[model samples]
Target chain A: MGEVIVITSGKGGVGKTTSTANIGTGLAMLGKKVALIDTDIGLRNLDVVMGLENRIVYNLVDVVENNCRIKQALIKDKRYPNLYLLPSAQTKDKSAVTPEQMKKLTGELRNEFDYILLDCPAGIEQGFKNAIAGADRALVVTTPEVSAVRDADRIIGLLEANEIRRTHLIVNRLRADMVKEGNMMSSDDVVEILAIDLIGIVPDDEHIVISTNNGEPLTGSDCQAGQAYMNICKRVLGEEVPYLDLEVTKTFFQKFAAIFKR
Target chain B: MGFLSNWFKSSESSSDIAKNRLKVAITSDRAICSPELMEQMKNDIIKVISKYVDIDTDGLDIKVTRTELDDDSGTVNAVLASIPIRATKPLRR
Candidate 1:
């Protein structure tokens, strides 16, 4: 049985799409047959982020509406032979498909792949409910901000209420420099407050934005943030990796200062 | 009034910012208390606690500071706030 993983966040603009793209790519790069399903219907973006937008002739809505077979809707990526994406319908709304339909959809795709990564839409509305129905486990995405953390807490509570027990946390958009300056919240602060197992921490990077423009994820880059995301994927596969401290990557002076601390 | 005299006489709004916003949020997140509710609680605690012992209602503080909040499962340290309640004069009957 394949693992259906929903990458969800209670608040919007916290990088759920970004996390999905990179982590899906990471898993596929690891040689696991992966299928990334975009559930953010009507506002589909995973295709664009995965740089597979032009190749999407059929979408999830098309599959559900019987306009095309699931094979035609699945887009293969050039980067990874095993990785595939089921793009969401840009023309239809979240209500275009029901949770039962989504569950059925994922159920069909399960046998063909080892992992099904669902890029869940933001908020706890119908879209949110639809995104989570078929998932065996959930990855709750949150940033180190007050509002995001608050929403994540609410989302965690909802997941608990729904009996989805194996929820994990992925803290994105961490500005280590700002954290050092006490201007931004640290990863420790977020983990302590959320009280959930930490899966990964993605530092804010210009590389991510640059890669997003090119429809590439940072996991392919040599940046620290990229390594962090890759390690996250490894951890997801049951590997033991130490957490990355994404502090304003210390300079020699700063490192020396720390070494000489009284 | 001198500068020092006016310094202590600033409006409560300015002082409000000095307090942490986390308390207000945690109270709501925990879905238990509110500032208005805390004020009401302060009044009740003063009224009840003053039955036997004297309390500086104005100086009497009830803080929900960062401390451990106990539960059935285990104890987790939570907000330990200081709520200051000043006692008022008795009715002139």
Candidate 2:
């Protein structure tokens, strides 16, 4: 069976969908047969982000309702032939699909794909429940803000309650300048409070907004955030790439070098 | 001034003075027990023990130590672990 990885967060607008798209793209770029499943019903954006919205004839609800075959609902990525996307329905709400239905759907896809990436909806509600029902492992995404970290903590507690053990964290929208000025929480502070292994830290880049508007992933670009997302994909693939160091080291030799250079 | 303060802070006697000073100040913030009660407890325990089983009178010492945490019921949390105390020295009149 293929690995089912769910990208989730307790708070909304923290880039769960974007990370899912880019990581799916990154993994497919590595020649993996990946399927991106958007479990965020009524707010489907994975197809748009993957540039496959125009071709979504049979959505996930249609497949679950037996209105269309699973093969018919799955949209092939325009760029990567090996990548497929199972788009959620725009008309129906999250209540339309049950956890058992999601599990059965993903199980069918597991035979044909290497990676089944589930883009979970925000909040620890019904949507979140439906997403992780069939997932093998989870990636909890959060920003460095206190609220986001707090919600992520609650989500981790919920995941543990559900008997999900292998969960990691992805700290998104990190501002290095704010952290340096002690205005924002540092990576150490976030990790300490969340009490989880750090998988990736994507800097807050305006380029993500541009990519979202253009319906393209940043993973194909030369952006630092793209490299971060790619690093997370590699981590999911069981690679041991080190994280990017954002900490500043102040020393006398460096100070003298700066003085002479200036 | 920074290095001068650091030099003064490194002296051995400063630790004793600091510990003595902190023991007086932090105990008030940490608990409802006053410093006088701690002293009274030591004297009462020494006197009460003199009337009963013989204890080292001049050697009897009692001090309040600040604890790191409180119990879940929000009460004073301190363990009265026996200190590796030194033997009392000869008392000069």
Candidate 3:
């Protein structure tokens, strides 16, 4: 049996798709068979992010509508031998897929892969409901901003009400310099507000934009955000990995002191 | 220097302000109680207390707030009511 995890954020553009692609890739790199499902339906972008857009013949709607088999709709990622993506239908809307259908689909995938990650759509709409219907665990992604944290809190409340007990947090796009300057919310601040176990923190990296534009997940790169996603994948696999020192850019005095100590 | 320090002391950083605002906003959101309900509760509390003693009705403070549990366990929200009394009437025997 495999674990079905839903990656969701109530607010849009907080890196849910990015996190889903990178973490799924990282998990596959770790030799785990992973299937990433794009549940956003009309607003599908996971296929593009994974660089599998050119290979998508059948989508989630096709599978649910009985037009194609589940295996036929699954797009095998050329970069990772063990990773696959089930793209959402660009023409169909959220109402096209029901919660029951999603539950059944994920239930079938659960038996075939080590990890099934559902890339959830933004907002607490029908799409969000469908994405989480078959999930065994939920990862609520949020940026270190007041609005994102507020939305994350609301999402947490909804998840708890739905009896999804095993919910964790992934703080995305954290800028350590802003945090140090007391301009941005820190990881501890976000965790305190959400009051859930934190799985990972990905720093703000320009490389993420470059990779996404190139249809390549940053997890395959050597950037700090890529390494962060790798750490998140390890944590998802039930490994104990310490967080990276995102605040490694020390001031002149601090760097000088470190040299003297050496 | 004094003016600069005073200006700094009077204003908080944006992040701190955001944190403080979220603390209150999220607590009230979790409580899910309407403002009218809280106001009615405050009035009832003052009416009950005024029967025995002279209370400052204008000074009454009642709100629903969240309190953290010990050592980062979690948070609990409750209706905290505070009624300030001026004095008690003497009993004639």
What DockQ, on C-alphas, does every prediction get?
A: 0.08, 0.03, 0.39
Interface RMSD of each: 6.8, 14.6, 2.7
Chain B: TM-scores of all predictions:
0.44, 0.45, 0.57
TM-score of chain A of each: 0.94, 0.92, 0.95
lDDT of each residue in A1-262, candidate 1, tens digit only: 7899999989999999999999999998888999999999989999999999989789999999899999999999978889999999888898999999989999999999999999999899989888889988889999877788878877877776566767899999888766654456777777767777899988888889989999987785698779888998999999999987665666879879998895
Give the lowest summed-lDDT range of ten residues in model 1 chain B: B11-20
Candidate 3 lDDT score at position A46: 98
- Who wins the TM-score comparison? 3
Clash-forming residue pairs, model 2: none
Best by DockQ: 3
Which 10 consecutive residues of model 3 chain A have the lowest summed lDDT? A157-166
Candidate 2 lDDT by residue in tens digits, A1-262: 7999899988898989999999999999988999999999999999888777889898889999999998888888888899999999999999999999988988988899999999999888889999999888889998877567667867776776576767889999988866664457766677765667899999898889888888888885787788888899899899999987655566869978998887
Listed in order, each prediction's TM-score against the native is 0.77, 0.70, 0.83
How large is the interface RMSD of candidate 2? 14.6
